[model samples]
Target: MKNKMTSHYAAKLLTASLLLLANYAFASDIVFICHKGNALNAKEIRTAYTAYFDEPKIVDNKALRPKLLQYLNMSEHQYKKMWEKQYFRRALTPPVVKKDDREVVDYVESHDAGVGYVAEVPHGADVEVCGK
Candidate 1:
């Protein structure tokens, strides 16, 4: 009985460790995607996400925001605060928040200048990856 209990505990620990590692890998592997018609590059993607771009329709994936913030080395509070400042100063609204990658891909497919980041591109999403 003791050995069985120990084995179960060990398995649980290993599974938890794997889950953490998977989340870290996913968070670090964000891909910036845009409409096929746009030519936005990596630098522009970074600037558009961290700074400002008034042209492209920006879509923020809520499911990927934690990973995005981790990649940007920003706390959730800081991210929201920065956007608040942008709104206050330049009246630049933050990106439209979507529930997941599917919504973002759909938006980009429909909008010519749409841009967004996603954890995984949907299988049939008619979008192009512009940045890593």
Candidate 2:
């Protein structure tokens, strides 16, 4: 009876692990989008979000903010506090927050200095996917 219970718990744990892994695998669909002429690699994208880039106007989708913050290795509250500190120091402007992926894409397409992230890179959006 003990062996059977242990096996059952192990199987359940394995299933849960697999599900978490699957979510992470699919999360790679996020692509960083920027204006057609602007290009940024992953490192540059990270720097841009952290307020190191002055030329590009950063935008973020509210729906994806938490995931993007996770990608940046910070929680949402931590990110906000960091940006607030940056603003207080007069170092950089906080990123413009948008409603969703569509709005982010639209803002990026319309502004030459715009940069944002979306779940998928849309076809002919007049923006380039700089990083994933």
Candidate 3:
């Protein structure tokens, strides 16, 4: 009985360790993605998506906001605070297409101009990593 209990505990520990490692790898591997042809850099993405900087280098079109903020390091409250300021200044328009990572991948795959972020390294032909 003692040996059996020991083996069960050992197995549980190994399983827990594997799960933790997998979670870490997934989080560490997540990367920002965009349309293949958008030609956007991190600064442009930040400016276009959020009012992180005033007098931001002009990028032609703006997309969704919260999703982009989620992509970046900003929390929802932080994004909202910045957005309120930008709204008063009339500096930004929210994005049209709201998509999660998989949807972003699907959209980017189909539309040449579609842009979005992913939680893992982009692998498809139409997706590009906009930021690290």
Over the stretch 31-128, how does candidate 2's per-residue lDDT look in tens digits? 89989878788888998898777778899888888678767878778899988988888668899999888899999999998899988876768898
lDDT of each: 0.84, 0.85, 0.56
Off by over 4 Å in 3: 1-29, 52-73, 96-99, 109-113, 121-125
Error of 3 at 38 (Å): 2.2
Candidate 1 regions exceeding 4 Å error are 1-24
Q: Each candidate's TM vs. the true structure?
A: 0.75, 0.84, 0.47
Instruction: Quote the lDDT for 129 in model 1.
Output: 88
For candidate 3, what is the TM-score? 0.47
lDDT head-to-head 2 vs 3, winner: 2
Question: How much is 58 displaced in model 3, in angstroms?
Answer: 14
Q: Report the lDDT tens digits of candidate 1 across residue range 1-79.
A: 9999999999999999999999788667888899997959877876777758777778899988988887777889998
Residue 79 accuracy (lDDT) in model 3? 64
Q: Candidates sorted by TM-score, descending order?
A: 2, 1, 3
Model 3: per-residue Cα lDDT over 10-108, one tens digit each:
999999999988756654454556666555676675566575544323221123334344455677687667767777787554344444556656665
Highest TM-score scorer? 2
